[model samples]
Target: MPVQPTPGTPPQATSRQQADSAQRVELGATIRRLRKERGLTLVQLAQRSDLSHPFLSQLERGLTHPSMPSLHRIARALGTTQQALLASAVRADPDVTRQAIRVVRCGEGLGVPNVGGMARMLGSPQLGVHPVEYRGAQTDFGDYFDHPGDEFLYVVDGEVEVDLLTADGRVVHQLAAGDSLSYLGGTPHRWRALGDSDRFRLLAVQNATDPLTGTAEPHG
Candidate 1:
């Protein structure tokens, strides 16, 4: 039989609420610690992460909770991953559920568009390697961009032309279905769709941590 508590009296409910409040406080402190360690003010972090300043302040004060996606952005701005921050939060909470494994269903990827295409984040809680699907990149040439860490790409559907612009010279590689390419980080590169297909699809996995912030390298 279920026990009903009279108005203004409930022990179990009160305990649960207290626990949740404590957890929120701990999470906020953890985020504040990380932000300070990175030498980032709330304004700087918010600008870099595309988050609003007031929201960040509220989060740091434990006055509000952030959704998973917002937490991911905050973690990235602090040079960490969402998985790491969640692990920290869980460590402080006594009522934690198992988090060793995660599964993302098909057609539910986080989609973000770039210069010439769409990039879908393959899974949540980004870890060591960031996996993304690049599709609908129908351009004659890509704006050369460079960032920290190595990159790998596999052509899953159609052919494409990739140009690797390094200090040595300009190298072009034409990739077809089932073709793959791996390149070192810091190499300026660009790509373009080929063979007259309406859309081109590729699986690009990057192991870079440094945020991309620059212009096209001069062709030399």
Candidate 2:
């Protein structure tokens, strides 16, 4: 037997369900904004991602959610990464003062899902720098990320390998704990955790604007 609601009582959503609904709406808005930034229509994006236009439309309308593979395809089509898309959907502090000077306590920040590891945003985008802390288990060669402005990475623990795709060929660099690296923007690069422990922590910082001209660039 099941319980039924009273005639005048309205159905209510759980907190988790409400959060999911909000995230869905934010993600849809992000996708639509990115598509418009690239000057792409729904049909064009569908063709680029090999997904159906109707499905893309539904996704943008927040009526549907995309699977991991579908999301990867969409991210690739948008010249970004799945992590970037997820991070963009995360709700930041609405208060301007909070955004200006905020401190993220341990284990407290915006979490990004399904990026082959655990990642959290430690800084707000309003500060002109996006800082994310990544904890990885096992060696996972994630997708390459390329965006405007400069990027910096610091190894907080364990070891990792970074590959930079250059005009001539791929350049690989092995880094241990306390090691750091910096590179110009628009350079394709990817990284993976290493070592027998199969665990590592990395801090990645990227400029939110062009370093040379101080112009805003695409997030993530």
TM-score of 2: 0.66
Candidate 2 per-residue C-alpha lDDT over 1-220 given as tens digits, one digit per residue, 9 for 90 to 100: 1224456554442333444455566777888988998899999999999999999998887677665457768877887655455545545333225436666657555455435566666664446676878887347676776766578999999998999987878899999999999988778988877774346888988776532233556543
- The best candidate in terms of lDDT: 2
In model 2, the worst 10-residue window by lDDT is 10-19
Q: Relative to the true structure, how large is the alpha-carbon lDDT of every model?
A: 0.63, 0.69
TM-scores, all candidates, are: 0.52, 0.66
Q: How many pairs of residues collide in each model?
A: 0, 0
Clashes of 1: 0
lDDT of the structure predicted as candidate 2: 0.69
- Model 2 ranges off by over 4 Å: 1-24, 36-39, 50-92, 95-99, 137-143, 196-198, 209-220
Clashing residue pairs in candidate 2 are none
Q: Name the best candidate (by TM-score).
A: 2
Q: Which stretches of candidate 1 lie over 4 Å from their true place?
A: 1-100, 124-126, 208-220
Q: What is the C-alpha RMSD of each candidate to the true structure, in Å?
A: 11.3, 6.8
